[model samples]
Target: MKLHAADILVIFWLGFLTVSTVKGSVASQIAPRSSCVDLSTQQLDIRNLAKYEMQHIPVKAVMFITRRGIKICVQPDLKWVQNAIKFLDKRPVTRRPTTKPKSKPKPKPKGN
Candidate 1:
């Protein structure tokens, strides 16, 4: 079988293109999902303020754009709200009372 120089060049270019495309897709998949989240410095600052001041503040919802560029907002979990509330309502925990009265047990009856 005779392999033409042009055929080899074409095969090399095609392989290179295919490899690059696959690498690009795999790299994108491995990248952190939050890297695309549009959390601005101002927004993050505002969120921090609300988190500190309010027991349950609704901050920006997380969103993702699909390959077709459709935006989808993910609902925050109920536990996240609870956590926020707990955080805001947290008070300094005090130490428990150290001294407790010891209970005395009755002596067992003598065996017959």
Candidate 2:
């Protein structure tokens, strides 16, 4: 039996939809979830912190990322949290050193 052009087009469209749906679910699962459910009141050393991000979903807090790749959630209005933010902002930016090209020496003058 011969398949009509319309039938082939319909099959292609259904396959495309199924693939996109599966891809969307996988992507959502792989995405990082940053909502803060619990917050800590302990004071953290500003030196150990690498940076911070404000978390507004599920709770209002500050998420401090440590140099060791740990995330600490703290209340935004806390004195220590505010101080840590200021300290991080004032810290100098670190940059990688760039190599410079070597200059060639000029040719010696020929004997007269």
Candidate 3:
């Protein structure tokens, strides 16, 4: 059986997409998911933020990162909002370390 360039290209593209899709799904599954999200950054004060479903919206999700840098996403309901709040309040918001901002180099004195 003879395979043309198009056939090979199609197979390669399909395989690449399949692998990427699988990888994405696996990565998502590996990520932590729950009702209460623990955040690393103290920047967001979850205490005041409203995370539950709003008047019109049926679902609302909260995203935060752990001290260990694990990101978590959760939807609010009756059962877990309080628990999540407590968990966040207890842990000090350890902000993600920021890299030094690159300063613009002073205009090089007109090259001699």
Candidate 4:
């Protein structure tokens, strides 16, 4: 019973493909039923979200929009979570900037 390099590669690929195709994954089964979701901006409370999670209802992660308009998901209980909430609360929501449109003229257009 000897395994070679090619045997190891085949075994790895087989495991990867099997895991990818399986509908019920080990990770999904192990998700904590009582995770936190803190949406302070939307008046959504943490306790309410926890209740939903405990009932096996999927609670989406709390997200924030950065200056660049990139959406970032953060865990509620992180040390910096409170600070981030405060920061976002204090700032006004601005229009998300889009990718540069192809205009043949001004490199830095001053027109608003």
Using Cα atoms with residue i matched to residue i, what is each candidate's TM-score against the true structure? 0.32, 0.62, 0.29, 0.29
lDDT of 1 by residue, 1-112 (tens): 9999999999999999999999999888854343223332222211242233211223445443433554433333445544544654573555778998888998999999
The better-scoring model by TM-score among 2 and 4 is 2
How many pairs in model 1 have backbone atoms within 3 A of each other, for residues 3 or more apart or on separate chains, i.e. clashes?
Answer: 0
Local distance difference test, each candidate: 0.49, 0.92, 0.56, 0.53
RMSD of 3: 11.3
lDDT of 4 by residue, 1-112 (tens): 9999999999999998997878557656875533435443333333222111111234445555444444444555555655556555565666779899787875786778
lDDT agreement of model 1 with the native? 0.49
Off by over 4 Å in 3: 33-112
Q: Which numbered prediction scores highest in TM-score against the true structure? A: 2
lDDT at 86 for candidate 2? 95
Per-residue alpha-carbon lDDT of candidate 3 for residues 82-109, written as tens digits (9 for 90 to 100): 5766666676656778999999989978
Error of 4 at 28 (Å): 28
Ranking of all predicted structures according to lDDT, beginning with the best and ending with the worst: 2, 3, 4, 1
lDDT at position 17, candidate 2 = 99
Please give the distance, in angstroms, between residue 106's alpha carbon in candidate 1 and its true position after superposition. 92
Error of 2 at 42 (Å): 0.6
Best by lDDT: 2
